[model samples]
Structure formats: structure tokens, C-alpha cells
Target: MIDYIMQYQSEIWQAIGETFVMVAISIVAAILVGLPVGTVLFLCRKGQLYENRVVFGTLNIVVNVVRSFPFLLLVVFLIPFTRFVVGTALGTLAASIPLAVMAIAYYSRLVEQSLLEVPRGVIEAATSMGASTIQLITKFLYVEARSGLMLGMTTSTISFISYSTVMGIVGGGGIGDFAIRYGYQRFETELMVVTIIIMIILVQTIQYTGSLISRMLDKR
Candidate 1:
């Protein structure tokens, strides 16, 4: 195993870098776009401050439609759009377009769910105190649900890592692609095991860090 790693260390490192690039882009989308989308879903629901059945229904349907597609199909289906946006349907950047879309849809649902977990009393209290919409969300809802949001982000990130693996089908190389090409395809079982172990360790570290911070932030 050691000899194998030393022999292909550069390639392995490059694959890991590609994976990071894809996952990083997805993470950014989840925060910048997904968070707001989910917050809107929460605020637009019936009886909420910004309640509007039309807005809620439209967003809900879009989220559902996106989520309903099998991820593999979603990647293939978005090829044209991805190509148009990135000028190519191959490489880490192009692959990231689909990953980002998936992240937005996936994390938005999680965000909505996390916000739903916020107590109704808290929202009511904020309203009674005359909090503006922005204030209610930032100072009340998000403050109360910070821990849940953290956990949700942790979950989304792990799913992103898993999803990035399949991007290799479009020439988006990552650790998984490295394993497939040099391990499975080449009968290098030890290399595959090493890559799997690397992924496991990376996931465990993220989960642990997220959980620790969530616990620290929890007031109750």
C-alpha cells in the first residue's frame, strides 16, 4: 500500500484537489443560494409572516421536481446547461455546475426543515417585539436554529462528497475516479482501499467538527 501510494502520490493528490474544487463550489452554492431559498420556503408557508400560497407552492414544486430526479439522471440532464455555463461538459469546473444545483436543492430542503424546527413561540415573540422580516430571520429564527443548521450543513456536505464521485462519468476526476481508473480498472485493490479510507476519515472529521460546534452553540 505504501509503495503504491508513493508511486502514484501526485495523481492521487491531484484527484483529491479536483474533489475539493467540486465540493467547495457546491458548499458555496448551498450557503449563498440554498440558505435563502429555504428561508423563503419557510417564510412563505401558510400562516407565516410572509405567507403566500402561490410563492410557497411554486418553490415547493420546483424543489420537489429537482429532488425527485435520481442524481445520476440529474447530472446527465443538466449536461446542456452545464456546457452552456462552463463552456464544456467535462472537467472539475463543468461538473461543479450540476453539483452546485444538487447542493442548492438538497440543502434548501434541509434548511427549511431546520427552520421548521424553530419553536413557534420564538417567532411569535419576535413578531410581538416588532422585529422586521430580516431581523426575525437573522436574530430570531436563525439564532434559535443555528445548531440544526450546522447539522444540516454537515449532512449536505457529506452528500456532496458522495455525489461528486459520479461526476467522473463526465471526465470530472476525483478520488473516486482515481480509485476506479487505477484501482478497480487496473486491479489495484490496495489503492482503492486507501482512497476509501481517505474519504471515510475526511467525512468523520467534518462530522465531528460540525457536531462539536453545534453543541457549543446550543443554548438549550
Candidate 2:
């Protein structure tokens, strides 16, 4: 283990950094884009504020279509768009474009579900207090559903990390790329084990932290 660490220490560290970069950017983008999209989805559903079948149906179809595509296919399908956005689709930055896109679609559904978990009674109470649509969502729905929202984001982040690994197949550099190049291709079992360990550690850390935060924020 020490020998492997010493031998590929620099490469391993670099791969770790690249993985963080990809996951961090993608997850942040996912939260920013998904939050509003999901909120809109919730509001437009049957009997909710701003409800409209045409609008809800249209957005629903788009989200489902994007989400249903396999990650690998999405990666390939978005190559042209990724190139146009990032000027190249073979590096960390380029890879992040697809990661963010997929994350947005996946996380939006999670966010929508989280928002739906908000109690209808709370919404009614807020409405009785003369809460505007915006106020009801911002104050009642968001506050009440924060715990679920956090959990959803947590789950999405973990999924993003796993998806980021697949980017390695497309030349997007990360620990996954490192594993493939050294561990799989070059038959370096120790290096592969190390990478796997690191990934497990990362996922566990995120899961624990997210759960803790969610628990703390959950008032009911």
C-alpha cells in the first residue's frame, strides 16, 4: 500500500482533485438549476399554484426524456453541445458540462418530490394568512421541505460522483480515468484498490455529513 502510494502519489492526488472539481461544479449547477425547475414542476402540477396541464405536461416530458437516457448515451449525445459550450469535450471542464446537465435533470425530480412532501395543511394555513404564491413557496414550502430537499441533494451528489466516473471513458480526467489507465489497462491492482477506497471514503463522508445536516434542520 505504501509502495503504491509513494509510486503514484502525485497522479493519485491529481486525479482526486479532478474528481472534486468535476463533482463540485456539477452538483452546484444541479442545485441552482434544479431548485427552480423542480419548484416550477411542483407549482404546475394538478391543483397547485400556477397549475396548468399544458405547461406541466410539457416540462414533465422533457425531464423524463432527459432522465431516461443512459448516462453514457447522454455523454455521447451531448458531445456536440459540450464542445460548443466548453470548446472541447475531452477534459474536466468539458466533462462537467454533461455532468451538470444530467445532474440538473436527475436532481430536479428529487427536488420536485421533496417539495411535494411539504404538507398541504401548511400551505393552506399560509394561504389563509394571505400569503402570496411566492410567499407560500418561499416561506412555507421551502422551510417545511428543507430536510427532504437536503436528502435529495445528498442523494443526487452521490449519484453525480458515480456518474463522473463514467466520464473517464470519454477522456475526462479523474480518479476513474486514473483507475482505467493504470489499474485496468496497465494491470495495476493496488492502484485500483486505492482509487476504490478513496471513492468509498468520499461517498461515506458526504452521506454522513448530509444526513447530519438534514437531521439538524428537520423540525418536525
* TM-score of candidate 2 against the unseen true structure: 0.97
- Against the hidden true structure, what lDDT does model 1 obtain? 0.94
- lDDT score of residue 185 within candidate 1: 98
Task: Please provide TM-scores, in order, for all candidate models, with all chains considered together.
Answer: 0.98, 0.97
- The worst-scoring run of ten residues by lDDT in candidate 2 lies at 166-175
Off by over 4 Å in 2: none
Which pairs clash in model 1? Answer: none
Q: Identify the runs in model 1 with alpha carbons over 4 angstroms from their true place.
A: none
Local lDDT at 213 for model 1 = 92
Q: Superposing all C-alpha atoms, what RMSD in Å does each candidate have to the true structure?
A: 0.8, 1.0
The candidate that wins on TM-score is: 1
The RMSD (Cα, Å) of candidate 2 is 1.0
Candidate 1 vs. true structure, TM-score: 0.98
